[model samples]
Target: MIIAVIDGMGGGIGAQIVSNLREELPTYIDIYALGTNSIATSSMMKSHANKGATGENAIITSVKKANIVVAPVSVVMPNSMMGEVTCGISTAVAECEALKVLLPIMPEDVEIVGLENKPLALLIKDCIKVIKKEFNIK
Candidate 1:
């Protein structure tokens, strides 16, 4: 299965997710890093994603082949990530056929009610759990 981990800005979140997945999932599962910028892509690549791509077009095309897409909720918000997320990028991610595993994290201006505020590490752990369940991994 292909899991696309999308992130922008410093790509730290994506990197952490990719690293955890690499350690937890089977080698056969491919992790693709889809970053809004080259720096983000590089960060995720360093964390051992099977492949990496940058920018809106790359993200738009890559999500098609992914079985799962994991990212912060902001990924679906246009103009999020300090304006790194474009309308096309957000639309593509939201409309993709893959199962989306989005963290509750969002920009300061947007507030999602009724969701517990968890630390980044805890959120990522939850992400891994969901992915493991989907893949039927122990």
Candidate 2:
């Protein structure tokens, strides 16, 4: 399966997800870190993503062909890093046949992690669990 991990700036969101997936996912699944910038991709790459891509166009192109798209909550909101998400990533999500899993964060305009009180990583872990079960990523 092709899993796309997207992020904006520091890649903390994508990096964290990538790191966990690397440690927990079976070796057969493919992980791609899709970043809005080089810094984002590089950081997630260091976190052990199998591959990385940066820039809005590259991110869009990569995500378009992905089977699953995992992004931080920020990726759904407008930000300076990727020059607003509506026309880029948002459009891709609207058009592509990819399954998206968004993490919980500030501002509240995007999707929440939806769980009992827990840390972000743990919430994300649960998110991955659902994704794995749904897709049978093992």
Candidate 3:
């Protein structure tokens, strides 16, 4: 299945998520990094996403192809620091057949949580475990 990880400018969160996802999911799962900017995309790319895309258009369009989407709690909002993402991204994410592994804060049924830094890693692992449980990976 195609899994996408989204982020903006800093990409720090995306980087960390990709790192953990790589170790947990391995090459069996196809992971894509959809960053709001080049910076975020590059950071995630370093962690070994199958491919990378950036900017508003790239971000929105890429999500359609993925079977799963991952993003920090931050990206859920409309007005990103880099620019505006409109409601389309959220709608696509909300409506997509792919399960989203969003982080920290989230809307009801969207799928998200807080993780990393000690217990943070544990939380992410649990989240991934849940993802694995729900889907047929490789």
Candidate with top TM-score is 1
lDDT of each: 0.95, 0.77, 0.74
Clashes of 2: 0
Stretches of model 2 off by over 4 angstroms after superposition: 80-86, 108-117
- lDDT by residue (36-138, candidate 3, tens digit) is 7798899999989889998777877888888778886546566544453456666666667777777663334444444333455665676688678778543
| By lDDT: ranked, best first | 1, 2, 3
| Backbone clashes, each candidate | 0, 0, 2
TM match of model 2 to true structure: 0.84
**lDDT tens digits by residue: candidate 1, 1-138:** 899999999999999999998998899999999999999999999999999999999999999999999999999999999999999999999999999999998999999889998999999999999988887888
Q: How big is the RMSD of model 3?
A: 4.5
Off by over 4 Å in 3: 81-84, 105-119, 136-138
Write candidate 2's Cα lDDT for 1-138 as tens digits.
888988876888778889998888887778998887788889999998888887778877988778888875566665534464546766675567888787666454433565456687887888789788988766
Cα TM-score of candidate 3: 0.79
Estimate TM-scores for all models.
0.97, 0.84, 0.79
Q: Please list all clashing residue pairs in model 3, or write none if there are none.
A: 104-113, 116-120
What lDDT does model 2 reach? 0.77
